[model samples]
Target: MKELSLYLMSLLYITAGVNHFVMPKVYLRIMPPYVPFHKTMVFLSGIAEVLLGVGLLFTLTREWAAWGIILLLIVIFPANVEQLKNKKARGKLPLWVVILRLPLQLVLIWWAWLYT
Candidate 1:
């Protein structure tokens, strides 16, 4: 089950990372205005996500990868909060979906911490 979770997590992040490049505009919408260079940040984060996801595949870097993922989750949290608080930032997402996403971040953090 642990291995399965890790595999799924890796795939989740990799797919998300790819989506960052494939659909950059989708992410740009949710970015907090205070953050500068939304496009660059999106691209860089995509690389980070892909690297961290790939790193998880190796025993030597699994813990580090997990830590990196946790850190990424923490770093992006403010944006999540912004998205929930500013309905316009969330675009078409229903209020309930935005609300539910806040707690989901915690779940993702916990899931990543399991590797650490």
Candidate 2:
């Protein structure tokens, strides 16, 4: 179970990281207004995600990578809040979906903690 979870988490982060570059505009839209250099931040975060995800694949780095992912999730949470707040303005994504996402973040955090 531990190994399976690690693999899934790694895949999750890697896929998300790839998406940041493949669909940068989607991430850009969800970023809070106060944030600066949206494009650069998006790209850097993508890199971080990929690197951390790769790190997870190694036994030696798995703990550190898990912690990195947890920190990354916390750091980016405000964007999720901002996205939820402006879901209507951003697009027609359902209110329930946004509402559910908040809890999902906590679940992701807990899942990351397991590796620590």
Q: Model 2 over residues 15-58: C-alpha lDDT tens digits?
A: 99999999998899888989899999999999999999999999
TM-score of each: 0.95, 0.94
Tens-digit lDDT track for model 1 on 5-74? 9999999999999999999887888899999999999999999999999888899999999999999999
**Per-candidate clash tally:** 0, 0
Q: Clash pairs of candidate 1?
A: none
Clashes of 2: 0
Candidate 2 global TM-score:
0.94
- Model 1 misses residue 5 by how many Å? 0.5
